[model samples]
Target: MSVVPAEVLPGGARAVTGTVRATVTAELGPRARLWPSLVAVYRAQLSRARVARIPLLFVATFQSVGILIMMRGVVDGGSEAESVVAGSAVLVVAFVALNLLAQYFGQLRASGGLDHYATLPVPPAAVVLGAAGAYASFTVPGTLVTAVFGCVLFGLPLTHLWVLAAVIPLAGAALSGLGAAFGLLAPRPELATVLGQLGMSAALLLGVLPPDRMPEAVRFARDLLPSTYGVEAFARTFGADPDWALVLGDLAVCAGVGVVSLAVATWAYRRAAVR
Candidate 1:
């Protein structure tokens, strides 16, 4: 058999080479489906966060519980008590989903961790959603404890407490997206932490404090806050006859803001990844 010259390959050999090149290109191309990558990222994020975040979750729950205890001394009942309880419950979500997530992403960015993710075939949305989902997941136990504890402390009926099931996720998504955006957009990790802290403080004050107590200016600012909708949604449930329509509207607003914020975070992730 005669060996073929390198530059004068037969048609069959050329076709085979072309087929192999196409196969390699297809194998090396970007991922098409996002769900599998999203799930993998979510699981990885959840596992990494579980151990490191437990203590912070404890602190978040404790802080909200402590707030309820303090409010117990001042407000015995009425709308003020309801506001305090609802605000405190949502605060747990803000602490972890917002504050801690910002810090995590900020530090991750600052430490060049994005390089690792950037090299992967995963979609940018998956990283943002996975991290946000994982952080938001941590808020559940804390939020539930805070809500139940606040309800018992204030003598509120548990009948409407079920509203928290909707409140936590809607509120967590908004807050988590905001946190991720802050972390990804900030110039430094320290700034991200500061932004997170300030955001949480705003949620605590504007959300927990009765709207009646806030000045017109402060109340206007509160109205602009995404968590305000969540607070209103949760607080309205405490009443004997809640306007379910209004409660759902508030939740819808929260859901909308959550979508917008997550979109922004995804953009921020892409921007940061390219940097």
Candidate 2:
């Protein structure tokens, strides 16, 4: 029998191919760190959302403004007015962060977008947090406008309006994570949209209306909703002698819920990406 060259042997060819693949992989560099990946994803999502969601942002602002106008008739002033204003401002956050984000991820899932994200070297948490942060950031302008307009309409003090600096991100984190979970967990895009709408409605009814006006059962339900803490924290600031302790407590609770919800969303994202 004739001796074959090593290059022509099957095992040698396999080894050569493996070596080439390894070299190529090494040249590609290490996987990205979480912070850099997060920032890059955030920038991409922000730009895309800016162009595509501007109309929805308008709708959110207009919707909040309209609610304030309607409630102005029923609630002249006082704590009830504060509730309406605060809840409505936070509602803008809910509309985009909770409602729109659900729709976005739902569509992404339906369209094989998760596969694209999975192909990237970024951490799953980076993807979830980045998208959530981008959507949440959109709420800032609409939220501020609603708060300022509502304060004027309700004759509430503008002094503590600055508290929203804390309120928006905390509340947005909670709501955005919830929205992302809803979207990723839903079996269908339609179901995701429905869940988002229902969430927003809950915020509208339970958060905007004063807790005192609710029945015991409804009040309990409101307490379960994360956005209520944000509404309460913000509404308290309108008081002449605002309870800083209570406000901080509410904010702390909101922050805690945000962390929990975001962790859940990250879990949901990982689960969905695998499929």
Candidate 3:
């Protein structure tokens, strides 16, 4: 019997074995911490979103502005004006955080983009939160512009506009998570787009239109919508003697809903990624 050298056991055998070992080692490697992974993903998504930032900002601003203009005829001032302005501002948030995000993740999943993320040593929660945060960040400019413009158009007090500081993130977090969940859970990309559009339309109708104008049943539906609380919180601040307590309560509801929605989104991400 002839003894064969280990290196010559088979053609390319050692190289193949080494490659397999490397792959397994990589697969078994420790993942980056959640916060770092979140930051990295946020940066990457932010960069990607920047490419189309102009159109998105334009659409968000223009849509809100146009709504304000139309409402100008019907609503002269007072609580009606407050609702319109606040609703329009949050509408910008809904456009980016809810609408665009849904489309993005839907496309991502449909194109097998989740596979790329799955290969990375990153937590699934980070992926969901990072994407949501990136999208939410885009809402700021549009929301500010809308709020300022709506205030000018409706002649509402700008002193309380600072309330948006609390409103944006809370509303954005809630809506972004809902958008991400919608995208990941949808069976098809087209369905996700449709759902996103419908959601925005609901926000426009239920949020922008004064609750007083809505039927009792419709008002109840509006109450069920997460964005409504954010809108209410912002709207209340426009008053001369604003109720800080009520504003805080509304914001608290928004924060609570945000947590729930984001949790759902993380769950959806894990479910979708495995497929």
Candidate 2: stretches off by over 4 Å: 1-28
lDDT of each: 0.92, 0.94, 0.92
lDDT of 3 by residue, 1-275 (tens): 67877778768464455445544334467868999999999999899889877697898899999999999999989999999999999999998999899998899899999999988889999999999999999899899999999998988889988889999999999999999999999999999999898888988899999898778999989999999999999999999999999999999999999999999999999999997
Model 3 / residue 230 / CA error / Å: 0.7
Over 4 Å off, model 1:
1-32
Return the clash pairs for model 1, or none.
Answer: none
Q: How high is the lDDT of residue 80 in model 1?
A: 94
Better by TM-score, candidate 2 or 1:
2
Total clashing pairs in model 3 = 0
lDDT of 2 at 259: 96
* TM-scores of the models, in the order given: 0.89, 0.90, 0.90
